[model samples]
Target: MPSSSGQCTCLRPFLLGSLLMLGFLLLLFTYINPNMDSPSLGMYFRPAPSCSHWANQDNSTLESDNETHHTTVLIWKWPFQYKFDSDCGVFGVQKCYLTDDRSIYNKADGVFFHHLDIHLGDLPKIPRPCFQKWVWTNMESPDNVPRKPWLDDLFNLTCNYRLDANIPVPYGYLVPRNSEDPDFQLPTKDQLVCWIVSNWNRNLLRVQYYNRLKDHLQISSYGKAFGKPLSEEDNKKVVSSCKFYLAFENSVHKDYITEKLFRPMSLGSVPVVLGPPRDSYLRHIPGDSFIHVNDFASPKELADRLHHLSKNPEEYMRYFRWTKESKMTISWFGKEHACRTCGYIQKHRKSIEVLDSTASSQPPHGLLTASSRPPHGLLTASSRPPHGLLTASSRPPHGLLTASSRPPHGALKS
Candidate 1:
């Protein structure tokens, strides 16, 4: 037999070889299958796809040709589909394509829907795994859409850009003073006051107010609910002829002002707005530009004021001064809205979820009063918000994986 020293030397080589093999496996395991349970490793193991790099290489481009390079936005609603090329980019470079093809819904960069049209309960689950989902609602009021707890968690963005005055409407809608046009002249007076109402019975408050106003003075009414519907041009001409137009909303809500207020304001007629509180209007429009129904003690008083304005051309024309100095733009809610959707998706590239209570904590200008919250049963378990559930912030919530680390919120319904 070999000496004890030789045996010890041979054994050392074998033991050393075994130790090296074992160390190699441990290193390979650490690299190939990381400990996902570790908080630090969790992020590294399952990294989120960067939103900016998701489509830019293929679908998205900085090119002016929208046809060649544009982010596709699927419209779930057929009637309210926003398809016109408003070219809403930093410098007229088209970047959004709003479509309605189910085939593209999953692949679409975003999905768009209106509050009045969609009901989430019926859908059961989101139709497609879109990168973003947008809801457009200008109709939610204390009496209409209820505030749901999940709204902040559901939608990725709010298509209701109307509430912000900084976002200008379509270019064609802004009717600036045409001093150069020989045909242009001061709007001639026609009816004392006009209301292009379609909801005659659904809203008892509106119908009751209309009746009370009529008791004092005559107010012409048009639309299927009252009379024959006027054409767009005819409606504009009629509103322009009138001294005042009732821009009452179906229901009152903060920042719920709609085209009812804007159309009359654009046409040089004083708008008697009745949707949001007067303060909300002041934020977006001149305080003197509109007459708030709440400001009047009674319908008779409102009618009297309207009558007085109709008689005094100088007093009535004062409402037009804001328009004279700075032209008012009306959003072609359809096309301009689509442009905004595109512009938003193109710029923002991050995963996020907004918290409702925080997001809707304040209105565009102020806090939500107790009256703004819906009464019990306004939001049922099965109740589907017409505009979907949540509105999103442009930035990603810090530590997006953790619910508690969510970013601050924004508004919905309004």
Candidate 2:
């Protein structure tokens, strides 16, 4: 009813007020929830190894699991007699139970049998139930895993590091979120290149590369090979303080990356890798986070690249940009395996499956093995966390010690 000029004048304050409110909301959202980029699930992380089919049929007792049933996965033998807590909830999965007591094996829905613990003569006494499934659990690489033809029909499922397994467990993973800053303060560096290794086999490709690398640069070496025995504390201090860590694997194969890579990565030291090709690592981590030894034409060229990056802060920080942006997730070893197995059984409970008897029993992929025997004077894990037992088969012997994990007497914790 008013004139055009008068109407426009009155609407000015309302438009200004709306614009101010909208700006405030956008700023609030941007600050509170930073990463608007697409999730890094398939890129950085391997989809968290979820139960592909989903949960189980209805069980009225538990209100949890969305009216679905709970499942019990029994470990036939504790790996290396290194026991872990049976709580599946600790790994963020629900309505799942894990147990090692052989007495209750009859009631369990599924069972896990470790490869190393299975002695041929000593086998399960009881007859297998029609519904009960025996899962073959092995984390050994292709070569080290001894062929067991007898196991062809025994295992209905597998638990290993392979992406295609019923329960896939990689050494570490990256969360799908991004932070404004990773809160990673660089440790004081007293060394340039650090190689903490016990296994010193010249025949191994990694050791051969290390010898060539040392010819080009001065590497501050530690561990049994160098006669400088590092305590658990010093092991970490060395990695954190060094500008770069040589995460050379004792053996090379697909998906054989181990704690040799993870320890330095978690410790804020860039890893000069010699294990799998760069493409294999790119699946688990960002492309620029590590320097693959193969990328360089020669060891001298690789050493030159290291020197150039060391002197240049901008170039070197690219290797650590992921730590500054995303949260890192370490494999809580046995906990993840048990939880995933529990989830897998619940999903496939209605669908009875029998593995083809002709299939090879050797695990396709797993924690890598060193080429030869473990180095001398091996210091076993003095302390062990309840997550899982660390075995030589699952890691490069004394791969690298972690702050919390207590690998078994012969196993290295990372």
Which of the numbered candidates is closest to the native, going by highest lDDT? 2
Q: TM-score per candidate, in order? A: 0.59, 0.71
Candidate 1 clashes: the total is: 7
Any residue pairs clashing in model 2, and if so which? 383-406, 384-406, 385-406
lDDT of 2 by residue, 98-178 (tens): 777676555566788877778767567666554456777665565565666555445556676655455666676665333
Instruction: State the TM-score for model 1.
Output: 0.59
Give the residue spans of candidate 1 off by over 4 A. 1-69, 77-93, 101-107, 116-152, 161-184, 355-414
Cα lDDT of model 1 by residue, 1-414, tens digit: 799999998899899999999999989987876322346323212221244553343434333223434576666664333334434452232545566666544455666655545665633253334244444333234354444443333444555533431122221223333454233245887688888866567446667787888899988888767766876578778988888888877766556666677767656688887766788777577787789989999999988898898788799777766765454444444544555566555555333232232122123332121222222112111222132211222211111111111112201111
> Residue 217 of model 1: what lDDT?
93
